[model samples]
Target: MSPRKVSLMSRILVYVLVAIAALYLLLCVALFVFQRALIYFPQPSAYATPDNVLTLPVADANLQVSVRPHDGPKALLYFGGNAEDVSQNLPSFSAAFPDQAIYLLHYRGFGGSSGSPSEEAIARDALDLFDRVYAEHPQVAVVGRSLGTGVAIRLASQRPAARLILVTPYNSLLELGIRQYPMFPVKWLLKDTFDSAKYAAHISVPTLLIAAEHDEVIPRSSTVRLYGQFIQGVASMKVIAGVGHNSISESPEYLKLIGAGL
Candidate 1:
């Protein structure tokens, strides 16, 4: 209870608090740098255009794209996984709809495309890609899977897509970012967390939302919220049973639903 004894206790408490603060700072740093690891993503691979390949250049950017056009009248413009080199899906796409022209968007960073991957840049590219594709084929659909759902929703809100498909979707990356890094200032610190639900209801296209019951990355709650929010617009939803996020697209029953959508 004496002054000297109180001083010793205060000093020890100060040292302990300082150590704790330093550790928390390190955690915040980890949250920012390793945030991508918390989410599942696949890197891209080279795409060989054996059929017919054409290069389309976007204005004010270094990302001129090469698209392998299918021999058909109706076409599809697709945004793929954040980490995915979407060109790798071309063979599966060819098999799925051999008659429809497919434009697999090479995202800014993925598929050797130029620029960095930010939410705004991807959304802008989505709109630009849609505009370009729509000019060529007026009756075209937009397909987005995983991270691309944000891109798809943004594009649909701005333009008219014949059909809009979202696979393993989320409501907002901002929400997820905060959840993963509560100690850090996620809202201010995060460079991009595309929130698709905010703009879903405004889209009037024939929308389709597909999610698995056991989605591990983006929760089913967010996907359902997005679907429910689309009540103002024309929308339909399909849930694949006994499947997780990544495997849902590969499910036979899920593909049957896709066949119906096409």
Candidate 2:
């Protein structure tokens, strides 16, 4: 290459490298300043499960849990949305799994629970709750929706579940991180990257995955990619035709999917 061209190319490369290094440093400073926001996954009171509901005491916090059994002798443990009030789903869960007992896990710092919530802590709480609930139930199935899918997959991977069901799931938090922070260097900055797709395929259980065609938060493509990761023969996938992320449960197709899968 000519000397002039080489000098220009080297200068551009230097500037690019300097920009990347500066961005990395800024990300570290931002994360450190907002560490509490990242670590403490708090939900608003509007999404609280129920003040009158029962609580299962965890190590440093408590979990709001509701148990309902139907005519059948089976059981289902349902995890809800990130900012959702799990108590709102209790009625539907009770109706759908009328023959089986159901337990709902409220995330830490959500509902009436205490303590902070992060990826590790939420997964830990889920596994612990599964142990307690599994002891009292048979044919236990674990279900997760949206953000809780991470906790569910972690628990299902470690525990013995008759089935693992995920609704409107994602490939990983890193994927979502890229979407929300396109310009930021998220892979290094993220403290919790819930990669359900990584664990879903390895989970040794009958699995059912449901995605909404019109999901707003998690793109249909992301859910589809995650669903694709499931091992063959042991897993199944379905989608609610017109439903979005929040209203997947409201769709008749979704109810049918859950009913048939269970």
Candidate 3:
């Protein structure tokens, strides 16, 4: 090859490399800047009636907790998914477990709650709610779905929740994020690790993990891995057939299984 052709080729190669490097840096910066937005999908509460709304001060934020107050020892505390409007499920929950009082938390920045949402903030809020509810209701069962599973697991491990139920659980947000963004350094970029697997090992109460047979959002393997982390005989997994991650709740047997677990 001529010397001029070799020089041109070298310059083109350098330009290509630089362009790729610049794109990568831009991606990293975007991930860092909007990480929280990627993790949390906050929305207003679906149920605004005075009968259902209860406010609790969580740190600096006044968290709105949806309550179905019943005078009894048995209570159910629920933490919902990222984009979920937990208040929408009130009717189903009330019908499913009419005997037990139910409390569903709207995470920070979600459902009209103040401040931003993070794994640490959500976990702290969950523990605070658990402690407060436990004071009144001795037999409190904790239920969590998707992102809330992390909060629930951590709370159950640290507190004395009578029964624990996880729906469409994952091993960890870090692991799932890594799988979703294999090309990037997800482990380093992800701020909300939500390592439920780490907390699962410490949970002492009877735990039931509800897994979707064809979960697309959270892989079935991830839920199974989380179930394995629990101490022997402490946790059991039940898979619902013909459902995906979000659709698991639509199944007729969804609430039935939860009632049975509790």
Candidate 1's TM-score: 0.87
Q: Candidate 1, residues 49-105: lDDT per residue as tens digits?
A: 545334556665555344657544577777877776777667777677776788887
Error of 1 at 254 (Å): 3.2
Question: What are the RMSDs of all candidates, in order?
Answer: 2.7, 4.8, 1.0
Off by over 4 Å in 1: 26-42, 50-54, 64-66
Span of ten consecutive residues with least summed lDDT in model 2: 43-52
Q: Write the per-residue lDDT of candidate 2 for residues 72-181, one digit (tens) a residue.
A: 54778888777776767777766766677777777777776777778888888888878877777657888888887877887888898888888888889789878977
Q: How displaced is residue 107 in candidate 3, in Å? A: 0.8
Candidate 3 lDDT by residue in tens digits, 121-232:
8888898899889999999999999988988998998999999999999999999999988999988888899999889889989999999898999988888889889999
lDDT of 1 at 255: 52
TM-score of each: 0.87, 0.82, 0.97
lDDT of candidate 2 vs native? 0.77
Q: Where does the lowest 10-residue lDDT sum fall in candidate 1?
A: 48-57
- Report clashes for each candidate as comma-separated counts: 1, 5, 0
lDDT of 1 at 241: 92
lDDT of each: 0.76, 0.77, 0.91
